[model samples]
Target: MSPKMVPLERATAPAWRRRPAALLAIALAWPLARLSPHRLRGALEFLSRGAQPVTAAEAEDARNAILGLSVRHGGPRCLERSIAIALICRLSGGWPDWCTGVSTHPFEAHAWVEADGRAIGENPDEITHFFITMKVSVSS
Candidate 1:
C-alpha cells in the first residue's frame, strides 16, 4: 500500500514546534552543501560554456536545466546553487556576482545574476543581505 500522506495541520504545530523543523532543514542543507562533488562542478562549467547570453526566458531555461541536472547528479552545495543561477545569467547574457547599491534601502547593497542589467529572480534585491557574493570569471 502507498504511504499515507500527512496534512499540514498534522505536521505544523506552533512557532515553537517549527524551530526544530527549520533547524533540521538547515542541518540537512549544510552537509549537502559541503558534499558538493566535482561532477556537478564540471557540469556547471560545461553548461556555462555552452549557454549563450539571451533573454530572461532563455535564462530561466538554463536555470531550470542546470538546477535539475545538479539535483539529479550532484546532490547539493553552495556552488551548485550559485552555478545554476550563474548559468542562467550567462545564458541570458548576464554575469554572476554583479552588485549594486540601493541608497533608499538604508544604503543596502545587492549582488545578483543579471542579463542586460535586469535582475533575474523574484526580489533579487533580497540576495544582497543574505550572501556577500564575489564574481568569479569562469572560462568557457
Candidate 2:
C-alpha cells in the first residue's frame, strides 16, 4: 500500500498522529543538510532506492503535511524541508524527486520535491527560477 500522503493540516487525521513522524524526518534532515553536496546526493539516492514514485498530488500533500507541522518548516529551510519530505515518502515506499538548484537573476539556492513531473508545493517562480543541480529519481 502507498503511504497515505494526506495533508495533515487539511486531513481529518488528528494533527498529533503525524507530528512525530514529520518531526523525526525534519530533525533527521537537519544534520543531513550539513553533508557535502556530493555525499548528500549519494545519501538521498541510497535511501530512496526501491521506492515507487508517488503522484504529484501525493507528493504535494506530503510537503504540505510538513508545512502544517510548523510555520518554520517550509520557508528558509527549503533544503531541509525538501529532504524531510522525501525521507517521509521513502519510509512509506514512495519517492519523489529531491532536487537542489540555484537561480541566477539574484543568485540564490533552493531545494524542492517533484513527482509526476510537477513541482510540489512550489510556486511557478520557484519552479522556473532555480536551475536544477541534482535530482534523485526512482531507479528504472
Candidate 3:
C-alpha cells in the first residue's frame, strides 16, 4: 500500500510586508514548487548564477524578509519557503545555499537555506544531523 501523505503545518503568521522583491520571488517559486525536486534545484541553480554569496546575517535577513511576505513556513522549514528565500535573495543580488535533507530514523524530510556554513535560523548542532539529499550553493 502506498503511504498516505500528510499536509505540513504552518509555523508563521503573515506579518510586515513592503518587500516587493520578496513577494515576486515567492510568486515565481510557487510555480516552481510543482516541479520535481531535482528539476527545482536545477532551476534555482540556474537563476542564482552570477550572484555573490550572502553572509549569515544577510541570509537571515532574506529569510525574515521572505517570511515577512508570509509564505507558509512548514514547522518553520518548508521546501517552497526555502526556495522562495533563495530566489528572493538572488533576485536581491545575493545568494545563499539552498539545501534538502532527510532523516532516516522515522523518515522526515526538510528543506532550508544556509549561509556562512550554517542554516540561517537553525541551531549549529542540527546542521550536520540530516543527510542532505541535495544542495545548491553559490557559484561566484
Candidate 4:
C-alpha cells in the first residue's frame, strides 16, 4: 500500500496590495520544493542569506506548504521545518536568525529573525526562550 499522505495547512491569501507579487513568488517555490535535497539545501543556503527581495507571494507559498505538510505528517518536527522556511524567506530579504525557542509544555520550536537584535512582529514579547543553534550572517 502507498504511504499515507499527510495534509498541509491552508494558506490565507495575502493582502490585496501584495497579491500579485506574492502569487508570483508562491508559484516559483512550488517547483523549487521538488529539487534534490542537496540542491535544495544549496539553494536554501543562498536564499537564506541572499539579499534578494522576498515578495509576499513567496512567503504565502512557503507558509502554506509548511503548514499543510507538517499537519499531514503529524510530527513535532514540522515546527522546525516551518521555522526554517520562514527563516529562508526572511533571510532572502537580508534578515537573520537572532533567536530560537520552544514551547515549554509542548516543545514546539520556533526561530526569530531580527534586524540589529530587535525582533519584528506585532508582538515580539510573545516569542520568548531566545535560544539559537546557528546563525547565518547577512552582509550589510
Q: Best lDDT goes to which candidate? A: 2
Over the stretch 64-129, how does candidate 4's per-residue lDDT look in tens digits?
444443343124333344344555455346334334455654444554444444543314665554
Ranking by lDDT: 2, 3, 4, 1
Model 3: pairs clashing at backbone N, Cα or C within 3 Å: none
TM-score each candidate. Answer: 0.34, 0.84, 0.81, 0.40
Off by over 4 Å in 1: 1-52, 72-76, 84-112, 130-133, 136-140
Give a tens-digit lDDT track for model 1, residues 1-140.
45333222112222453344333433333343353345434444454564455566644444444433334312323343444456445544544433223333334333334555455443555544443333333345
**Pairs clashing within candidate 2:** none
Candidate 3 lDDT, 50-101, residue by residue in tens: 9999898888777777666563653443777888888878876889989889
What is candidate 2's local distance difference test score? 0.79
Task: Mark the regions of model 4 whose C-alpha exceeds 4 Å error after superposition.
Answer: 1-17, 26-42, 48-93, 96-100, 103-106
Which pairs clash in model 4? 6-72, 7-72, 8-68, 8-69, 9-67, 9-68, 22-56, 22-57
Q: Please identify which of the two predictions, 1 or 3, would achieve the higher TM-score against the true structure.
A: 3
lDDT of 2 at 63: 76
lDDT of 3 at 91: 76
- Which candidate would rank higher by lDDT, 2 or 4? 2
Query: Worst lDDT window (10 residues) for model 4?
Result: 70-79
- For candidate 1, the per-residue lDDT at 65 reads 45
